[model samples]
Target: MRTRLMEAGLHDGATWRISPTPFLLTSADLSAIQSLGQHLLRFTHALNRLYYESVRGAQPTWVADYLDQGKPPDLIAYARMNRFRTALPGVIRPDLILTEDGFMISELDSVPGGIGLTGCMGQAYTDLGWPIIGGRDGMVAGFARMIRSLHESREGAHSPVASAEQRVPAPLPNPPQPSAARLAIVVSEESKDYRSEMLWLAARLREAGLPAQTVSPDDVIFTEEALFLAGSTPLTALYRFFELFDLKNIPKSELIMYAVKKGHLALTPPMKPWLEEKMAFALVHHPALEPFWTHELGADTFELLHRLMPKTWILDPRPVPPHAVIPGLTVDGHSVSDWKVLASLGQKGRRFVIKPSGFSELAWGSRGVSVGHDLPQTEWAAALEAALASFHQVPRILQEFRKGRHVAVSYHDPVTDEIVPMPGRVRLSPYYFIAGEVGTEGASAGPPSAKSVELAGILATVCPLDKKLIHGMTEAVMAPCTLA
Candidate 1:
């Protein structure tokens, strides 16, 4: 089978390279894999519910999208297979396929490319001196484990419907390892922090016993000879064009995936337009300048979710105002006047929290103004002007105030959906002003809560445009072009 795939140009050195290890499995691996598959299914289901909630007003007609489409039978079969207490008799093939709607279990070979993380997992396991598993096989096992952990954790508890079971076979034998090959790591001088992170990941890969090298992006001059030797054009060549603009610090790598700062130079005018064409990349953090990047986070996450999921949804920030700004309310059959906006706040008698629309951190002296206390009439008017000015700088939203303790939930795929909650923190001073309180301690504690993650997951499933916008934003940031 592997030989046939190679002859068909499906293996490495042909067109799309198939990893050497295919379906490495043991009887013990089945339970873990099943659990992960189940979790992914549940998460997808939950996301679908959230999506429905998000687009209810905008596209009320498409409300029954999930139920109307119906579940793919392959997914049903795979779901059943996950619940089998004992290893099934037949050769179990876990074919989890991700689609726009959700994941369906398809033929094993039908999965898409860019799943190198599975190989990384295998390498990690091997480096740990565990029994060597084939790369492809390790991916299958690892994916199974990830799904199982996610399922058991119930992170998708918000899902409206429970996941149904399907029968799947037990693990097969270990496949052969592929011949050793040199993988390149592209780096640029400009992004030292990113370059350093890549180098660190490479070192970690090396510790996992994989041979890896870090090379400067500019240094990787692409020529016909080099391309011929590698049996193809080096992907790193794409980034070299940016050097014309003295963007020498940009890093490029065929083997290492790039991570760009969300709203920084990576997505500046010169680079964004060019990078959008390529689908080989994935973005890490959502870009600040482009709020839509958050939608694309689901693409990778959906790959993790689609084993047994019916659908998924994501939130659209457009309709909902930011939590900072207070929504205007109707009073006595008429809308409140602007003059009364602060007057209304004064009457509340509590500290009023002001936030710029879509912006998180409160501007200095603009954090929380205690009505009638910290804000006297003179000061209140001035602060109100400042808040309104800053709000107008972009889009602004306001929230009355959240005096409750802040906590965050982190979603982890551990063959169960694990939601870990931690305390949230706010910085009282800037790092330069108070290093300990503002810099390190504050930064670590500002992540969103578990409820936020759940909310985000739901929103992603509902809004299709959100996903497209996010992908566009991510590509723009990660694959910025250099000026000629």
Candidate 2:
């Protein structure tokens, strides 16, 4: 497995301890994880609506105020535009930490990495006769279906007979074959480390009968009406592999948005910056929004999300009244009224995490995360101070930290050339793909519909037991998940 991964060229110069065997999950666990996709999808749809309603006067204005804290006005307005109102992320990956009872969702990534890497691992494990959770080519197939759906829907929307509401589009006289549609996974300079994996993904898509390519932002060519590659290679759709925070650094970003706005280009994980914010999880827990979420997400999804999402508090510096305490947050059996009170908690009482909410370069890859128990008292205090200071520009969240249960995993030690058992904590990343269903000629009139969310694959990053963050590192064991 190590040799196969080394030869796969999907690592992009980073290295990890390769596991000799796949991570084992019980049948019940697999079913739960697979069932999570639709709930997450419905949650995402509700969150989008929440944001939009807040922008108008339907929902609380404070909700919009919280989401738009650090965002530029122009970008915020662009995200609220009607042309892209129905857009939702095509890919969703939640970082789930396995605990004693079950698992807790630590974070959700709309523009996540590891698709191609997971695909490679899936193929490698399948070749060894392991029954991988998703099929050997599941990732590739799922991505292809998503892009094809995007292209078909966009093509119909831009047709001469497209409706203003975009509920449905007129049938084309000659529809292009799904394989003939070209796709560009435009990687930004900030995301160059994962470019190789996306390139590998494009190759797999090509093999699955979809014309796809991975290119840098500089390689994109934008005319007044459409976007293309350097060689005038027209594209049918674009998978934005970059984050909105890095838009200023991205070349021709405005042009790309222009094309999308002009209905000349189709993009996934759409340009909704609000959807990329980690604060959505915090909002889901807000008591004032409970009725709103309950109405939009239904009782079951609302309850499930509440259970899965840990207690998260946005580190707002503004003071509450002396009588009022931060809802759902307490330390030492006391209702804390000020954020600074957290700075005084002892190590045992400080089992919390501070991380950037989103729209910042430090938000991803565990860059700006501070674990309360892992640091000294002084450092924890400083982390709290910094989070408060940056609340206006780059908001941060304080979340209850749940420790992962210890487990044993075997990895190949290149120096010893033997498999060795290593005890570690696991972080499971399950990739879910959302594809829309094209309406038939006589279908009822309404908004476009999507099929059930597909669980493409699950990648497990088992870090050494001592490590606080379970991410891709030299000491961590990276592998696919399979049935126990």
Best candidate according to lDDT? 2
* lDDT value, residue 386 of candidate 2: 98
Model 1 clashes, total count: 67
lDDT of 2 by residue, 435-482 (tens): 663322111112223454789899999999889988888888888899
**Model 2: per-residue Cα lDDT at residue 300:** 95
lDDT by candidate, in order shown? 0.26, 0.83
Q: Residue-wise lDDT of candidate 1 within 1-484, one digit each (tens)?
A: 2243233232322222222222222343333343443333223223333333323543233332222222233322321221211111011123332233333421111111122333333344344444433332343332222222222222122134534221111121223122122234444554332344344434443444333444566454444323211343332111121211233234333211121111100111112111111000111111221222225224544445332322111111223333432123333445433433444445345244333322122211233322333456667566555545543232222323322222122222223444332222111100000000000100101111111111000001011121211111211111100011
Return the TM-score for candidate 2, rounded to 2 decimals. 0.94
After superposition on all C-alphas, the RMSD of every candidate to the true structure, in Å, is 21.8, 3.7
Q: Which structure among the candidates has the greatest TM-score?
A: 2
For residue 198, model 1's alpha carbon misses the true position, in angstroms, by: 4.8
